[model samples]
Structure formats: C-alpha cells, structure tokens
Target chain A: MSKSIFYHAGCPVCISAEHDIVSLIGAENVEIVHLGDNPGSIEKAEKSGVKSVPALVTPQGNVLHINFGASMEDLK
Target chain B: MSKSIFYHAGCPVCISAEHDIVSLIGAENVEIVHLGDNPGSIEKAEKSGVKSVPALVTPQGNVLHINFGASMEDLK
Candidate 1:
C-alpha cells in the first residue's frame, strides 16, 4: 500500500501540491487521486474527512488539510 | 459520521446485503455507496482496496470482503 493518498482537484494549487508531494514521497510511494476527474470523488474524499483539494490522507488515517494554506480561491 | 460504509453494485446479493447491513446498523448509521450507480465508483472502490461489490469498509479502515460468499456470478 502507498504510504499516503494525495487528493487533488486539478486546480493550480492541487496540481502543484501533487507535484510537490510526489517529489517528496516518490511517485510509487503515494497514491494520487484527482477529484476533478470524477465529481463523485469529491464526495468520497469529503466522507473520508477531507475538506477540500490539495489534501493528504496520512498513513495514520488522518486527513491533513494541506489545502495550500486555505487558498480555497484557487481550488476548483 | 456513519459507523461504516457499505459498497454495493445493485446485484441480488448486494441489495440483500445492504438490507441486512442496514437492518443491523440502521439506515442512519451506515453510509451506503453503490458501485453500479456510477462507473467511476468501481475504480474508486478498487483503489480503496475493495475487490468487489457487496464489500464493506469498516470503521477501523479495514475492507471486509463480505462479497456474498464469493458468489461473483451474481455481480454485475
């Protein structure tokens, strides 16, 4: 299993956050899921405790809302 | 939050399992997600470690493969 899950909405921040997370954890170590690719994913991610994009599901099962420091304006 | 998540595919087993799980946990206590309702959900569920429908995601984050005793033939 991947060490963490990165949820993004394909926004500017999300895309850049994905790149940074992938760079930090290596591509294979993290699972990247696009909320923008599927609208239903947003619901699923929220149900999983994610408030918005650029979020990370930590290995400890906690949703780390790294939402670009509350830059919700950039999220789609 | 719901006590658990029930993944169904609108199959005979899945429908019955949903009923049973709901009966056991009450409708308001469990969140039911139908994999057949949205094609994209199948991929999401698989990524969540759900091998097939009629599966259950436990509160502890464990995917219980209660796939109707593996009677996959009935799954759509």
Candidate 2:
C-alpha cells in the first residue's frame, strides 16, 4: 500500500514535519502533494475534513492522520 | 529597499498567500524565506512580533506586513 502526504509549502510546521517524515519513511515511500501548486487543494482538504496541512492519507484511504505539530520522534 | 517575505510551509493559508504574493510582486522582487528551512525562524518571528506566516518586511525594517488570507486583488 502507498502513502500519500498532502501539505502546504508555505506553512512552517508543515514543511518541517514533511522533512522529518521524509527522513523517517524515505522520500520514495511517500508521495507528497504541495497544496500551493493546486488551487483545488482547499476543496479537497475540506472534503477530507482537513483543518490543517501535513495530513497523511493511507493507500487504502481508510485512515486520515492529522498532525498538530508533532515531534521528530513521533514522525520517526 | 528590498522586501523580504517570511512564511511557513505547513499552513494552508500561508501557502495560498505566498502564491498570491508571488503572482503579484513577481518572484524576483520578493525574497521568500521558508521558515521550515531554518530552525531559528521561530526566534526571528518572535523577535519580529510575527503571529503568523506570509509576513513581509520592508527594506528600511520599519514596516512589517502580515497577510491574513488576502485575495488576489489585495496582493496585487
């Protein structure tokens, strides 16, 4: 199963967490979508009930993970 | 005088606004600093009294502009 991570490039926390995630999971395993690149991301986020960036969606599409400023250890 | 814009990559609003600013001022005229790139950004933001991302600082260092989800028109 693949994991997709949707994030905003302009948010500090999101960017920081993304790097940590990449470090932990390796960039190859994670598919990153930069919200700023897509204007429709807001609507997608709303549909997915996303209130913040750095949201993680599992390949099965059954789990949605929201991080409210996670530590490096948590990310790892 | 140069203009420096500081922003976070994780926040949706910041990413949205940063794009607007880029579209408005042109990428060359704007010096964008992604806060996630620098761990010291938090301290810099605190010292500059920044409560949010997409903060713009003028060359003279007299004016600090903070964008709270501005429209394209406002950005232009």
Off by over 4 Å in 1: A69-76, B1-76
- Number of clashes recorded per candidate: 0, 10
User: Cα miss at A6, model 1 (Å)?
Assistant: 0.7
User: What is the TM-score of candidate 2?
Assistant: 0.38
List runs of model 2 lying over 4 Å from the truth.
Answer: A62-76, B1-76
Write candidate 2's Cα lDDT for A1-76 as tens digits. Answer: 3555544544676676566545433587667766666655656655655555555544444223333433222322
| Candidate lDDT values, in order | 0.61, 0.50
Name every residue pair that clashes in candidate 1. none
Interface root mean square deviation of every model, in Å?
16.4, 16.8
Per-chain TM-score (chain B), model 1: 0.77
Evaluated with TM-score, which candidate comes out highest? 1
